[model samples]
Target chain A: MEATKKNSWLTENRRSAIAAYLFISPFFILFAIFGLFPMLFSFYLSFFRWDGLDPMTFNGLDNFRFIFSDPIFYSSIQNTFIIGLLGTLPQIVVSLLIAFALNSSLIRFRNTFRTLIFLPYITSIVAVAIIFGLVFNNQPFGFANYILSLFDGGPIRWAAEYWPVKFAIATMVFWRWVGYNTIIFLAGMQSIPRELYEAAKIDGASIGQQLRLITLPMLKRIVMFVVFTATIGSLQLFTEPLIFLGRGLREEGITVVAYLWRDAFVYNTFGTASAAAIVLFVIIITLTAINLALSNLIGRSKRRVS
Target chain B: MSTKEVGEGKFSIKKFFVYLVLVGAGLISLFPFYYMFVMSTRLNREINSVPPPFTPGNNLVENFQKVTDSIDFFGSMWNSVIVSSTITFGTLFLCSLAGYAFAKLPFKGKKVLFALILVTMMVPPQLGLIPQYYIITTLGWLNDFRAIIVPGLINAFGIFWMRQYIEDGVPYEIVEAAKMDGCSNFRVYWNVVVPMILPAFATLGIIVFMHVWNDFLWPLVVLRDPSVHTLQVALRALNDAREMDYGMIMSGTFWATVPLIFVFLLFNRLFIQSLSEGAVK
Candidate 1:
């Protein structure tokens, strides 16, 4: 009787385990269908030559080879880095400063300012991009040029010029993102004990000195998180450039993902787009790894100093 | 000597400067929206005038009509509502279900499976676009609402976020008691766990809604039929076709963004509270 009861208990436990799997099985099923299979297929497609509808011809390594030799590809890579650097670096700094200012006792109406700043972030990118297109229009009467003309500047052909187009897109990115990073940094700053600042002030430290010594050091982890997240976001920069430059400067403002989209969908060069995507993926992973390694190194040094 | 007095005077000066900077920043932040709204009410000629229209004009109705004509604005809006609402509802149900399982249930491979789910969060959606497109095409799902809704129903981030809240907020003993009362596991999850995790549901729901509502790329890729396009996609079409019609485009853009603004204002407190709480963890 004891043996039978123990066996029945084991069966009951097994039945519940089966039911639990039934409940959570959707994720695995969906992942297999949408996530894993596509990734593996993309890898396989990278080594072929096919215009999406045609038979994919096996062309091992040719697409990758072409990617290296293509000047446009190199330029796109250069543009990606420049835009990423221009967009992410200043955004992080400005966000940190704003976060600090808001955290300071000197400021008032903190929540209002925070909400206003964050509004741009939550706004639809398409709307913002369109608004910015008008603002940056190369016409003599464009908003940007009109403002610049006040300072005795000539009307700039923003879209026609390559660097100007990149700069315009970067500005939009900055405008939309700085507040988001500010909010994140502000959260990080608030978590730092007020006693740290109190003690620093007691030792006759100036506000700037306290920021440099206490705020910066304590925010290292959050900064790393911000950097890595921003790096990934920057690598995949799309819609802003797409709408800002429009159809004329497709190549000029072509981000990597935009390029991938054009190749895959517009030109139907699915295989090559897959290859480019694979390379882009690899670059992102490498950069993230480097960021992690650098953060780790900095973290260790900071720990030793403390 | 008189160091305290000097320090107090300097501190007041610093406070004055701080307010100046804060107000300036606030103006800069709000100026774009002002410009957008002002431009939306101005005609093309007024918009292009040498000085440009700095104030709102009386072209709001005209621009609204133009936007409606340029794109099926109502149709696209309805599509967006349907798609975003569906995704939000699906995400809440599926994520809450999986989150509850991971949090309360004692199941085999629960730890390993949850870890696997978390790993997907790191893989950028862009990486899978090519193959996902292929799969969608193969399944004949292009332009189908299901194409947009089904694949993204149970996202990893939602599940992870829901799990985090469930783990922290929901008590496992309550679930045990429910089970002891001859309730099935599903019943325990539904009656006991769901009610307790409403705040988590709200947070995840808002995030998911905002994302789906504003999503441009996937919708742009999958939906080829103009009739089936979402608001963002329709706005893109209008933007491309009528680059010169600042009023119409702005009006359309304004309409597209207004719902989000409403949602943000409505849930502003919860939004900020969740952000701070999530960041702390």
Candidate 2:
């Protein structure tokens, strides 16, 4: 009887395993075809010179060497970092403040504010870029310049000028993303226990003191999450700048990803584009690792203190 | 008594400052959409006039006509609908199936396979664009909708999200009970597990739809024929044609953004609630 029951159980388990594999087979098949094979093939192509038509010639490390010496490659990198910093720093500080304000008891219609702000995030980036392009148009009647005039200033060439192009792109990035980070930060803020605030208040902590002592310290993990995502996202910044600067600005604000797209698709420099992409991937990974280590250290120290 | 009064006065002043900052920030956050809507109604000359019109104009119908002529607005809209809907349904079904397997079924090498899926998330999509383009071109699938819809059907993030939802939301006892009733493994998942994770399905559905609808780069690369172009790519063609016509471009943009705005307004609260809850995990 025991042997019969054991055999039945084994048979049942085998049947379930078969079903499970059948269910998961689609993902495995698709990933193998589209995801894995393409990745490996790209790595292979990185070592060869191919222009999408002719037979690929093995070039070894020539592509990498050429990329290193290329002036346009360096400029693309500089533009990406400058735009990333300009966009990311203000976004972080403003999002934290917005999240803090929403978390406070003094705010009215809190949910309304949160949802309204988050609307920008859900709007299509292409649409956002198009709208901002018109607003930043260097014409005499441009909305931004018109506003500047109200402040006793002349119309600024918002898109044509280099610095203004960076500012315009950064502004769009900030507008679209601030609400996303705010929502994330609000989640982090809500997770903090109410008793922490009460305890701080009893100790005669002022509002700013409580924010510094109780809020920021508790928000370390959330901050890390935001920073890491924002950093990775900044590295891959393409669409907004591509639309805004590529069309409105003098093509001088091309991001690294945009540059990659132009080279691989437009210019057909496949090998060099692949090399640039690989370099970007390495930079992103290194930055993410540093962020993770720093966050982990901070988390450990906070745990010890508590 | 004087010190206490002083403290109260300072607190009120700070509170006023906080409200002021919040209001200012909110306006800045919302100003672009406001501007887009305002610009869509004005004519080209009006848009380029000094001290541009701050309010809505009466030229909306004319601008709409130009927008339609510049791009096949309805056809591209249909294309977007078809593509986004197909991908969303495919992702929901396939991802849920895989997620169920990872969460409930005890299979050999499951841990390793799950880890592999996780690692794929870190590999940026741009890295594979060249090879992917070649593959599609070689297979003669360049202009086919399947090129966009199929490859992205079962994404890593979707699988991971569904697994997370299943692990937390569904009970193993239900599966065991279904088995005792002589139900097949597929029957258990189809009848029991899927209903339990409907909230997750909705959240994932919205995100996937939005992404596929707004996607520009891949469609631009793969689909060259105007008939095969999605809405964003079609709109880009319009922008290129009348590069200097701010009114027509703004009108096209305004139309492009309307559907999403409508969807968001209808479900914005649900989205926010789900997002907040999802973040807790």
DockQ numbers for every candidate?
0.55, 0.56
For model 2, state the Cα shift of residue B45 in Å: 0.6
lDDT of 2 by residue, A239-296 (tens): 8777776633245577778877887887898988888877887887789789979988
| Chain A TM per candidate, in order of listing | 0.93, 0.92
- Which runs in model 2 stand beyond 4 Å of their true positions? A1-6, A152-154, A247-251, B1-11, B276-281
- Our model 1 lands, by Cα RMSD against the true structure, at 2.8
* Interface RMSD, prediction 2: 2.5
TM-score of chain B of each: 0.93, 0.92
Model 2's chain B TM-score?
0.92
Which residue pairs in model 2 clash with each other? none
Q: What is the lDDT of residue A211 in candidate 1?
A: 85
Tens digits of per-residue lDDT, candidate 1, B1-281, equal: 25445545668876776667667667877788888899889898888888787899999999999999889999999999999999999889988888877877778788889899988877778788888998899999999998899887858887788888888898777877786676787888788889999988887787788778888889999998999999999999989884569888898898888888887877777776665455445
